[model samples]
Target: MDWNSFWEGSKDLSTFALAIRAIILYIALIIATRLMGHRQVGILSGHNYLVAAGIVSLAAIRMLNPESSLTSGIVIVFVYAFVNIFLSYLDIKWPKTIDRKPTILMKDGIIHRKNMLDCHVTIDNLLGQLRLKGAHNLSEIDTIVLEPYGKISVIKKPEALPLTRKQMNLPPKMVALPTILIYDGKIDEKNLHAIGLDHEWLMTKLREKGIANPKDIFLAMLESDGTVYISI
Candidate 1:
C-alpha cells in the first residue's frame, strides 16, 4: 500500500504542522468543555443545551476553515462557557430569573387540559410518554410533571402500584452484577482483576467455549453464578 500518498493532503500546510494544530485545538476544546461545567457536558438543561450547540458549531467552523483564527475560536468558546456559568449563578441567587418550575400536567388521574394546552403538550404526547414509563392508563397515575428539559415525569399512585415480593413475604435472593471480561475483542484486565480472576482463567474459559483467543470472542461477561458467558 502507498501509505504516504494515502495520508497526503493539500500542500497548504505540512502534515507535521496540521498534527500540531489538531493537538492544540483538541486540548483547547477539552478545557472549554470542562469550564462549561460537568452538568452542561453530557446532560444539558434547556438553555444550556442551546449554548452548547452554539459552541459546537463554532468549533466545527474553526476546525474546517484553516484560514479562521484559532485564537478567536478559543475566545468564543471561553466566552460562552463563562457566560453560561454566570447565568447559572444568577439563576441560583434568583431562582425565577431564568428557570421555571416544573409544570403539572395531571393531578390525581385527571388530566389538567388547560395546563397541558399552556405547555403546548397534546394528549397523545402525554399518553406516549406515560406509556414509555409503563403506565397503561391515566387511572394508574397520581401526578404528571413536565420537566423543564422537555421530558415528562410520571408518578404512579401508591394504591395502583404492582405488588412486590416483600409484600407477599418472599425471601430476598443474593444479586451480584455481571462483570465485563472482554469487550469489542479486547480483554478488560482491570475488571478481571477486580473480580478476582486473571488472564489464565479467562483463557481456560475461552478454550472450553471453543474460542482459542480472546480476540475471537466479541463479548465475555462473568455472571454471579460463576458462569462465563461468551458472545461471538
Candidate 2:
C-alpha cells in the first residue's frame, strides 16, 4: 500500500490489521532468534546485521500504507530495539551458547589458508587488518586471531618488541605525522598547503627525484625532516 493510504484512510481498519501483524511478526522473530541459537545473538555480527535490516524493512513496509497500521510501525520499530537488547543480554549471560569464539586466522607466522577460507576472510582482508593492527611484518608476527566481532588481534615476535626510548633512558624525539602530498597519482593541494608547501615546491622535489610528473608517483609523503618519500 502507498503512504497516502496510511494517513488519509480509515485509521481504525489499519490499526486492527497492523496490531495483528506486529504481534505475529514479533513472536515469530523471537522464536526464530531462539531456534537459530548463538548465530543470531552476536552484537553487530552478520546474523544480527541481517536481522536489523529485515526487521527495519518490515516495520517500514507496514508504515507506508493503511492509516490504522501507521502507529503500529512505530511500535514494531521500538519492539525490535527491545528484542535486540534482549538478544544482547542473552549473548552476555550464556556467552558461547549464543556466540562462537574468536577464530585463529594465522599462527606461528604462517597463514592458515584453510581456516581463512572457512572463516570467509581473504588474504587481502587479513593483510589489511594486520597492517591496521601494527603487524606490518608477517614474519615478525607470532599469531593473528580473528575476533568474533571482527577485530584482528596480533601477537608480535619477541625480537620485534625491542627496547623503547623510555627503557633506554633516552629523550624521545618529537613525533611528526608525515603529510601525504600525493596518493594514487593525485596531488593533495590542501594537505600541501597545510604543510606550508606549494605546488612549485612539490614539482621541484619531484624533479630532483627524476620524476617529471606527479601522476607517475603512486604515493608521496612529505616528512617533517624535509624529506619526500615516494612510492611508485
Candidate 3:
C-alpha cells in the first residue's frame, strides 16, 4: 500500500461515494459535539475551544478532502470530545486546574493598574466593560472583577446605590416577569400555557384590541400587571 496513494483516494472516489462519506462524517461530527456538551460556539475555554476546532477540522478533512480511514477519523473525533468532557469535569471538581482565578481590576473606586497589567486588560478595555455595566466613573465603583471568560462583574459603591421604593418608605409592588405570547407573528403555545392563558382567550383579547388575528402582530407580550402589549 503506497502511503501517499492511501490519502489520494478522494480523487478516485465517485460523487455517490463522496455523498455517503459526507453523510457519515456529518453525523459523527454532530454526535461528538453533542457528547462534549459545549453548545455555545466561540465562548469556550482554551482547551474546549481547541477540541472544537480539531473536531471541525477532522470533519472537514474527511468529508470534503481525502476520505482517510473513515472509522479512524470518527474515533479520533469522539476521543477529542471525551477528552474535552473529562477536562470540564476536572474543572468542576478542581476549579483552578482548568480555569484561571478571576482578577480584581478595581476596588473601592480605585483601579488596580498592576493587576490589570498582569491580566492583559487595557485601560480602554476596562473603561469599555465599565460602560457596558452602566458605570462611567471609576470613583463610583466598589469592585470590578474580571472573569476568566473575558467578562466583567461590576459592583457599585454603597453611596452610589440607586434609591429604591424601600429607601423612600413606598409600598413595594408585586413584580412579574413579562412573557412573550407571540413573536414574529407566531404564537408561543408553551409560553401561553405557562402564563395560564389559552388560545381562545388570546384570540379574544386580540380582537378586543382591534386585531382579528394574532399572526398580524409582530410581537405580543403579557405583563404581570395584566397588560398585554401588542407590536404590529
On TM-score, the leading prediction is 3
Q: For model 2, how many clashes? A: 5
Candidate 2's TM-score reads 0.50
Per-candidate TM-score against the hidden true structure: 0.73, 0.50, 0.77
**Per-residue alpha-carbon lDDT of model 2 for 82-118, expressed as tens digits?**
6665766787798677766789887887888998999
Q: Which residue pairs come into collision in candidate 2? A: 6-67, 14-68, 14-69, 15-68, 38-98
Q: Model 2: residues >4 Å from true position, as ranges?
A: 1-43, 55-68, 169-232
Per-residue lDDT of candidate 3, residues 91-157 (tens digit): 7898788868889988777888899899988988889988988899887889999987788999998
Alpha carbon deviation, residue 12, candidate 1 (Å)? 8.5
Candidate 1 lDDT tens digits, 47-116: 6887888888987776666556666667778888888888777767976668777899988878888999
Q: Give the TM-score of candidate 1.
A: 0.73
Error of 3 at 43 (Å): 3.7
TM-score for candidate 3, residues paired by index: 0.77
Q: Answer with 2 or 3, whichever has the higher lDDT.
A: 3
